[model samples]
Target: MMVWTNILVPVLGTASDAQPLSVAKALAAPFDATISVVFASPSASGLFNWAYEGGFGVTDVAVAAIQEETERGRARCGELLTALDYPKTSFETVTADDWLGLRSATRLADVVVWERSAAGGHGFFASAFQQILLDERRPAFIADRPPDVGGTIAVAWDGGREASRALRRSVPLLKKADRVVLLTVPHAMARPCDGARAVLYLDDQGVRASTDVVHTHGDASPAILDAVRKMDANILVAGAFGHPRLQRFIFGGTTQYLLESLVRPALFLSH
Candidate 1:
């Protein structure tokens, strides 16, 4: 079994979040893990284009700020690791013209921690959360708050391939958590016993878990959120973009709801 030893956090120079690093440190504490903080800085040409396109007029100061931001990110990373008492931390700064290089960095980690979009900003990733959800083969932890360490974990299971994969990949986290709750909602093909099987599967892996069939009247997202609150779960692990791309885009989906509505419990999403 692969332990979450190498954690990667890619920071977007435009309003980044350090909570991901904090949460990763907490998760890695037991294993004495190493965190690699990669600062994705925009190229000078990219910054020049942004300034020119935005009618701000490119200036030496503007370009210099971009360069300085990368250094600031490195300094902050070191400070945060020291504050968190995590010594096995390393920092790297990469200048990427686009999101491609950033996406590639995701592959280098056993797991990735992503910060939710910041207000009045485009967020850490230039692309949609879907891009990371789909592109990264590893589990992506997206959260607005620091995830509760060793607290209750709520798994949103819908009996879909995406949900199953999320559950399977969640074992490492599950092992770390104090309790696991398998949360399921009604669907066309979903059987009540389905959640039970998930419970049994977790039991096989020595994860203490129970299943709850949450009843919801309207949009399932609210119900899912309700379940998380009622259970007081620290993290909500679920599948992302489960619907077909076109369908999900046209008519929003559960992942979209969780991202938009719930802000307390951190989201651990996978596809």
Candidate 2:
């Protein structure tokens, strides 16, 4: 069983941080976890590239303007954290190298939380999301909304290594849930008995969970989403499946599908 003592929430100086911050608060409630909110600013080179694409030449003035904007973003993040007023929280500003700073912070955190919208696009947040899951192999909670931590939680199991890691890492949250359902797709599993095993594992961790086998013909995302909706689960814990190819990580079909789903439960994922 995993115990989350530190929860990291990376913010991009946008209002979208609210949802993930709220989720961090809710998840922290049961464990009295400390929330570390870090402001991740785009690197100077990245900002310059964006400005160059926008018809602005790289000049002293351009660089100065970018620096000023970065400061403003950091200040904005600070103000937002102040407004949240979470008791067990700390704030930090990471500039110069966004990825390096985030990577370091993630290493110290048991779990990282990000806004769901950040999981898409080619922006810094999206890249960070992928890096955290694939490269860092850390558990992340991508919030679609403020999650009900005590509500029904669904675990997507396939008896794979990633699935087992996700389940084990999410034990703390599962133990706090009002209900836990282990959802499995028989055809998709290499070993069909993993679902039953998962139930036993959860039971051993003091989490009483039921099992449900979902039958699907094609893509598993639809059936999984439908089952979650029918059960009214607030969160879906699953393993993020992906592989590195030519120095880039490509998400597996089901993982990509779930990440792209516009309407779904909050995803608790691990790679």
Candidate 3:
């Protein structure tokens, strides 16, 4: 069976209408299977940045702007999909309700592709979404391009659950990968998790894999970029290796590091 590759775009309850169109563009950008779009509805009221910027303290104007953005976004998405020469979609919407895990008319997603918006103060929601995708065992793509183009992939293998999860999730691109590297950071934790680790796992799964042992640079972000260039990899895969705030449950070093990085497209699987 073909693995599903998903593109998740955040509508932020404002520009959600554009999500399906964005997904369609991403899907058409590559030669692949199963492209999907997703939007999350706000469960609570929050400040509308655009509305606030426009000096709209009036509730009616604020409501109108949000609805208009949502409607136009959706219609544009449909038109884009049609223009791109894809079949008419049976599914598309802006909602927060749906069992994403089940095959339903409303949910036709296998993975999520989120927009990488810059952090607004504390980026808790994006971080939460990241953790959700990891926990769900689904790949998350923070897109730089419409659809994540898969050519070369860099796998940060340290024999951990998250790293391994990233590698496993990357199976869809592996088949079409021109090159792939299993980069190992010689940190304190280099024990093998059985053939369940990376190298061995990739072999068993019939994915083209190779390995490289390197010292962990000051931080992993730049090191990852160096590896990407050295291996000519466009996509980077790694476990979410960061500290989490116990009280707030916010992400720590490595997670923040990767997200802050503009080096390459990375797939982070959380533990």
| Best lDDT among the predictions, by candidate number | 2
**lDDT by residue for model 3 (158-251), tens:** 6655666667766766656677787765543446433235666676767777777655645555665677677767677665533342111111
Q: Show where candidate 1 strays beyond 4 Å.
A: 12-16, 49-65, 118-121, 124-128, 187-193, 246-253
C-alpha lDDT of residue 111 in model 3: 53
| Clash count, candidate 1 | 0
TM-score of 2: 0.88
What is the lDDT of every predicted structure here?
0.70, 0.79, 0.52
Clash totals in order:
0, 0, 7
lDDT of 2: 0.79
- Superposed Cα deviation of residue 146, candidate 2 (Å): 0.9
Tens digits of per-residue lDDT, candidate 2, 45-159, equal 8878777899977888878887888788878887777877778998887753648788877888889997766665345588788777778888988776678889999988877
In candidate 3, the residue pairs with backbone N, CA or C atoms under 3 Å apart (3 or more residues apart, or in different chains) clash, namely 7-113, 8-112, 8-113, 17-73, 17-74, 18-73, 21-77
Which residue pairs of candidate 2 clash? none
Deviation from native of the Cα of residue 258 in model 1, angstroms: 1.3
Ranking by lDDT: 2, 1, 3
* Model 1 error, position 120 (Å): 12
Candidate 2, superposed: residue stretches over 4 Å from native: 45-57, 96-98, 242-253
lDDT of 1 by residue, 15-86 (tens): 344577777777667767788777777788887888788887878887798678767766776666566667
